[model samples]
Target: MYDIAVVGGGPAGLSAAVQARARNKSVLLVSGDVRDNPLYRTERVDNYLGFYNRSGRELLEAFRSHADAMGVQLREGRVLNILPVGDTFYLSIGSEVEQARAVVLATGVARGRKFPGEAEYLGRGVSYCATCDGMLYRNREVVVVGRAADAPHEANYLRELGCKVTYVSAQPPEGLRPDIPFVKGNRVEIQGGRNVEAVRVDRATIPCEGVFILRSSMAPDDLMTGLELENGYIRTGRDGATAIPGVFAAGDCTGVPLQVSKAVGEGQVAGHRAAEYCDAQQREEKTEDKERM
Candidate 1:
């Protein structure tokens, strides 16, 4: 298990990992493909300290190189789910599950609006991670509304579980199984009673027992079910503390000025607090064990 798992690979995430590593803590920086980061689209960064109008990509490379030099373990995979179990956080990264004592969410921000009825039927018949909930729909039909590169892989997981999978998206999914029906649509909606019954993509309706909605980045509320969010951003303090213990958030995902310097500062604070929290928890556990003796 890692001392901490820092999600996302942007400036905020990179800073968090680097700081945690500096504390001599083993950190697993769980990030998806770098292309998914909105920062990749930025052509130039002029305001960040110590950098003179360098391109965003250049800055990202520097951040990555720094982390690498620190020997931080970087895992290039999307965090499908983060479940708090006892004193540790269990993260689902594709098919593999890893555990960490603390978690830092720096996943930038949620980019798109949720589909109609998606939130209302979240657990009933909708899910975000196929690996987490695919077995529940064994022998059933499911629709995967994918907005990420891994959508097809998720569909395949559902199919492997004896479920009929239909991929719904604006463009044909790459690496998708030929047997799985692909429906091209710009807009999609989930309609059902008690459970998901069908998905309507534009004018076409495809019946299904479940719907798996995958996005490049999940909304803060959806990322951690009970975590507090204010107007779509994770509500965090200057220390990056959230409502949940052992969990923290930083960067644009937290809200506003949306600047690289702001993200870096918040990440540093979060990394430091997370290290302290973990150290304190360990000390308490040791004390309790000693008392038992």
Candidate 2:
């Protein structure tokens, strides 16, 4: 288990991981494919202090290098869920689970709102991680809603798993298996009663037993319940501490301006505070043990 788990690899998450490592805490930074990060695609970023006229990818690479030098463990995957039990936060990344004493949520703004009936059937017949639920739908029909950069790959995986996979997205999917049919649709909705019966893609309705809505980043609140939000952003204090103890938030997930500088500053605060929280938890556990004796 790590002392802190940062759920993003953008400027904020990298900064948080670096700060936590600076405090002598073990940190695990989990993020999706780099191509999915908004900053990675930007042509130029001139606002960040001391890094004028640098491309977003260049700045991101620098941040990643700093975090790597600080001994922060990096994992590439989308965090499907975060369950806080006791003082430990259990993060479900794909089919694996990681434990941490504190969590730093820097998941940039989750683009697009939920589709109709998406939330109602979240666990019934809908899922986010194809790796985790692919086997269940083997030989069964399923729709893969392609949103992130790796969605096509996931669709291909499902097809390989013997699932009759149908890929649906706003644009045509690249790298999708030729056998897997692709549907072009901008407006999509999940439809079902009791369980997912089908997915409605624009003018087409495809019958399926399961639907995988793959997105680069799940909303902070969706990942962890009880996370307070203000105007669609994760609400946080100046120190980046959220209402949930031992859980802090920073960067675009916390609010606007959404500048690289703001993200880095907030990340520093969140990482430091998370490290302190871990220390306090350790102290409390020690005290309780002594009292028990």
Q: Could you say which candidate leads in TM-score? A: 2
Off by over 4 Å in 2: none
TM-score of each: 0.85, 0.97
Model 2 misses residue 291 by how many Å? 2.6
On residues 81-162, what C-alpha lDDT tens digit does candidate 2 reach at each position?
Answer: 8999988999999999999999999999999999998999999989998999999999999999988999999999999999
Please report, as a residue range, the 10-residue window in candidate 2 with the lowest summed lDDT. 215-224
Clashes of each: 0, 0
Clashing pairs in 2: none
lDDT of 1 at 178: 89
